[model samples]
Target: MKEIVAVLGPGSWGTALSMVLDENQHEVRLWGVDSKQIAEINTEHTNKNYLPETQLSDGIVGYTDLEKAITGATYILFVVPTKAIRSVAKQVAALLDGKTKPVLIHASKGLEQETHKRISVIIEEEISSDLHDGLVVLSGPSHAEEVAKKDITTITAASGTDEIAKKVQKLFINHYFRVYTNSDVIGVELGAALKNIIAVGAGALHGLGYGDNAKAALMTRGLAEISRLGVAFGADPLTFIGLSGVGDLIVTGTSIHSRNWRAGNLLGKKVPLAEVLESMGMVVEGVQTTKAAYELAQQKGIEMPITEAIYRVLYEDADIDEVIRDLMMRDRKAE
Candidate 1:
């Protein structure tokens, strides 16, 4: 059955996902804050700034009006940055004041800075449960550029309930795009968010002229700390080995398409954090996530050396080389 889906955020990932829904024969309304971009998407059938090479589908419409974009949609996919999730959810909740609830699915990955809350927790806190059926997280190693070109990609749709996760699985699954359902929402989300931090470290290693052996070692040890902190926060350790975990870490850490990796790469070349952010012109989620994770680890008394090292590089202006030296000098321990 065809459904009306609202994809909020006109970024590359959101635009790519809108294309996916269009491929599934659903009516997609892509909502964004920029009216010019929205008009371009509606009239020109392209989002040059984001998906410059791909042509958008006719079935997908762009909207700047938040209420109109979501008014009658049966599903809402929030693809905005983590920082914007709360405000967007509040707006959606207000728009759905007395209307039927829609299924809420988010693809953003990050932990809230000060509060250290997950994306779903932020959304749930702002939007009353009455206005939404359930919260689901769609995550994996899939990249927007590859997905836009119809590349084979697999991801996970996780919710507290199997029924909700399966519902999302059906909504997105297709030949080139495979969707798996997982009941470990906490694990899935943590794996999705935490892997980006490791990716930054991976990119930094590359930027510093590190060879395959060093990169391999970094990834192996990075996953260890990620799983350690994740387990401390009540996430299943096995999820880290799955798509949202090791899978995401591999792609995000290695792929040039990843904004976080790119940012770290620039940092490795001795670029300032502000300069890197300005040059990229997109959110580098791992930077903020590193800070949040470091804080969370300290608060929870969890040992996460890689996360702490990245935090020092990003926040404390520590020299990347010195940080690497300190990391290497740490006492040896069993894997």
Candidate 2:
């Protein structure tokens, strides 16, 4: 009933997950690239930079050395940013070197910018199959700030194999945290990655001072856009209506805690993209994800007008007002 888990990344999400594992009575080896953060977690039991005002459990130990962190660990949860997934996974491959086969689970959401591959796909590409059990993705509307404070949250653990999904479900389920399993890995991953784009749009609408009516329209149509692209990529349409799709879109788009939404809010306020990102002090995944989704939509011949509009404003020098006007002036169609 006990598992030794290696959590790669010591950010808010990673620390919050470590707390969940500690609550579930698992020995968590929390790994981080920052030596100061690791020392703080080890000595003070606090990750102040990320999760302020929270004390971590003694069952969770911090490790700076990647090799030392994962040694003899049964489960490796990759909670790093989307961009860091590949490099960290490569490190896992070089260090593990056929020593132990642990179940690989990733909580990071987003597709690689150029390749447009899901986080799970990128991990599988970097880490050999022999080094771990089949992959599982954990995702939903859950936010690190809420989860860190013991708020009730539900998320989906998806894998190609139901057995693997169930294994992950049991590992994180507890009083405040609930985990559900889904077999649609493609749908789940796409929903997880693509929702951030929609969230950015929602934040932009908010920043522009649009009220409930406009926000409702954006979220509704955003789901339509997400569903269209997701179906083209062979994902189940039903998955979009579920937690990882609509659920994640709702929370991330509306919550101030969401970096993607915050970034979009700043952009809507006419703040420069570079300044917004620099001020956030965190990875605004939606910014990069919008580019990837725009490219993917073009490649797949899927029409995603909202994503296109956001992409233009972020990547191109297009004005947000002009982009919104162009979106409204598009050819009329039945919804």
Backbone clash numbers for all candidates listed? 0, 0
Q: What is the lDDT of candidate 1?
A: 0.92
Q: TM-score for each prediction?
A: 0.99, 0.98
User: What is the lDDT of every predicted structure here?
Assistant: 0.92, 0.91
Candidate 2 lDDT (Cα, whole model)?
A: 0.91
Using lDDT as the measure, the top candidate is 1
lDDT of 2 by residue, 1-335 (tens): 99999999999999999999999999999999899889999899999888788988878999999999998888999999999999999999888866678899999989997999999999999998988888999999999989989999999999998998999999999999999999888898999898899888888888988888988888899999999999998899999999999999899988898988898888889999999999988898888999999999999899999999999999996999999889889999898
In TM-score terms, candidate 2 sits at 0.98
Model 2 worst lDDT run, 10 consecutive residues: 93-102
Per-residue error for 105 in candidate 2, Å, reads 0.1
